[model samples]
Target: MTGHQKTAFVTGASTGFGAAIARRFAADGARVVAAARRIDKLAALAEEFGPTVLPLQLDVRDRAAVAAAVDGLPAEFADVDVLVNNAGLAKGLSPAQQADLDDWDQMVDTNCKGLVYCARALLPGMVARGRGHVINLGSIAANYPYPGGNVYGATKAFVRQFSLNLRADLHGTGVRVTCVEPGLAGGTEFSVVRFQGDQDKADAVYSGVQPLTADDVAESVHWAAAQPAHVNINIIELTPVAQSFAPLRVHRDTD
Candidate 1:
């Protein structure tokens, strides 16, 4: 509220949507706290954006560590005006029957639990200050389920509901919440992570047509966050023009 340039805390910021969002915030004159599990990738923040970028090595799945990081934010970056919950991933495109339990657990922990942990740690401050925005990165899978979208889609569904619920609970608190859902995003580690390092499989997801880039999603985050203090953008669902939904699957017996 004082002389502090709007401070934004961004998770999963080492690459992809996280990094792109961090860059956008910094470009718009906001002091950005970029947190991720990869410290080496985070170093690129200082190289690219100089001192305004506070790189913090974080794994949101670790509740204790997440709490410690938020509680220990430096005096300069303590007053967070915006929180971008972007640390999420989808593992393996196999059907539920063939899915790995470990993959399901990891996705649940990171996509759902990790998000809650960060929000629980930071929302109190936002409510106390009576001015803050929480922007969550959801996915279209939340609405339109596919064969292999199982746990990943469920996690995003949680995000969608959580954002709406937060808005409801913070009715008179001057706080805003938004969920940005993207589909078929390209040029990021998402597919790579999802495919478990299979570059060929990852590339195949976007081989035929161009898909939304991390910057595009970042732009959406920026636009929502840049709204007037009195305005709140609820949910922004985006996908490339080349993408769309298909009819429900119905298998008929050939007997």
Candidate 2:
């Protein structure tokens, strides 16, 4: 295959935004390497996208596993032109003083360190090729801190800044870095994971609100990826019309 048919590596592709992004890339005619911790779910995606979708078991928090998985990519998909770091979540809703240290550790490990691991493992090749794109999934919480988003928000802030810094570091090279921040995304595992599988709590997050869906965010990523090589979109924050910043919410009690 020609260099134009280069592959894309997407992390956290089991479901939600990650899965949607992977499928979108496949539909756009790029070979996609979809990685996630859930092998069964990845397998399902591979079945749907056919041979163009290569599903691999990966846990971003595991540094060695991340390196091994990227190193193990097939020759056809080894020369990646795009890398999407979308494997992250918020664990608990607690004040910084009352939050569990374990939850904070998990967030930092997966969101911050995991991104570094993937970038370190794959970026050298992109730098050498002098052409590539890196899209890091960020959150509105990165800018507007909420009562319960103490550490999760901080991690995303790191992602936002890191993308800019990465872009600076890659100056003169053809590689581009971008941060995609989404606010109030529904129909995904985000709130569900934040609520620790509490279906009622997860459902309440989008109650009576038209929140952004996984496809909305996926479409934004696709737009960024398809931009001309000379055009580099820095940061894009997408939110649902029904939702605003945390302090802007109006609550009503119906009797």
Candidate 3:
């Protein structure tokens, strides 16, 4: 979606993978509509990229706001060729029994509902135009669940299935859907948000581990989007060499 003048709308563009993806497309000459809740960070992005980047303050969790944002885009950016649903988070790391209900609600709202809202809003336009790509940010947790990954992982699993179902629905519509799942990514506000602003706890998640960087994830997204129109990438799951599968947990009762 780059190397020329294509419009790419990216959510959660305030920082991390979203920001990196926005920059990646903009640097390649694509018009980028960088949307996020933090206007200041978006402003910084627009300032850096100048006219190529249109910074729009957006909270994807708000369905009405998403509809309005999409319908209200300026003439130049209204025709979004690519929609990157990158606005999502993990609220808490506690196990299910001890988890906060509010955290679970938030995870579902942002990671699941918000994503569906964005896709629903943009898909029609893509179909009308006969060409578009929806790049969703999923997680390895969707397939490989960890103890504390309850709601977060479930929401991503929803994302995975939803992407596949979308393909089934859009078979010959000329639109494509791809889910990019990453494991143990670092250098993002993801952990900080999950830990509820506890910097120390967030830092510990990547300590002594060369986790996947935001750029790595962005590059994967870029590659998927840049593929020829004939090729539709179903899913791209990746992780750092330092990260891989773990042995199944075994529990034994002690008498």
Candidate 4:
């Protein structure tokens, strides 16, 4: 493993944090495999990064597709030294009593089961090689649950626990696991996707404040990946200065 150029596999790399992470790793001289469900978007990323980036159309929710993609990777990028589990989303904003069960299922399937599938598919090779790193994208909701966060928050909590448990299980195996949690990230598909493409509503989410950008989270991911093999950064929680914690910001009809 020493002196060999490393390869990184990042899920959800069509845009947002995943795209930034893929670019950063490519710039750092690591061969990057960027996978997402959007083939055209992934093609654009590959075009932008050239041969160093391999863009594959992959849906994390499909276990068979995930395995096929991983197994079909070229030999040069087959032995992934880093795996970033970043394919997830928040579907509906509703309280537990009113929440859409379908949305809840999607969140759980992607955030938890999808992450598990990726890890399970990749970890054995990492362990066999005796060197690798795993970075799972968590959120502030994991610790500070809000009324509408319901299942989304719960899934992140699972991510937090899963990362720690993976670290424990992989102890002494030269494999490291980390969870990167961000508070209020903007300039990504987060709010847009959450609001289901309601531009006005999405814009309102970051209207008056400067939220953390995809680059910020990407930088953190790079920092974790760049650490020495022996050094395992457990969890990193990053938030913009303007945001502290989740709260109901009610604006009365002053006018």
lDDT of each: 0.94, 0.92, 0.94, 0.92
Q: Which tens-of-lDDT digit does each residue in 55-89 have in candidate 2?
A: 88899999999899889889899999999999999
Each model's Cα RMSD? 1.5, 3.6, 1.1, 3.4
Tens-digit per-residue lDDT, 1-255, candidate 4: 247798999999989999999988888888999998997888777887788899888889999998988899999889999999999999878788998888899999999999999999999999999999999999989999776998999999999999999999998999999999998999888888887788889899898999999999999999998888789999999999999854667879978
Candidate 3: regions farther than 4 A off? 1-4
Q: In model 2, what lDDT does residue 147 have? A: 82
lDDT for 176 (candidate 2): 91
Stretches of candidate 2 exceeding 4 Å from the true structure? 1-3, 246-255
What is the overall TM-score of model 3 with all chains considered together?
A: 0.98
TM-score: which is higher, 2 or 3? 3
- Per-residue lDDT of 123-205 in model 1, one digit per residue for the tens? 99999999999999999999999989999999999999999999999999999999999999998999899989999988888
The worst-scoring run of ten residues by lDDT in candidate 4 lies at: 243-252
- Of 2 and 3, the candidate ranking higher by lDDT: 3
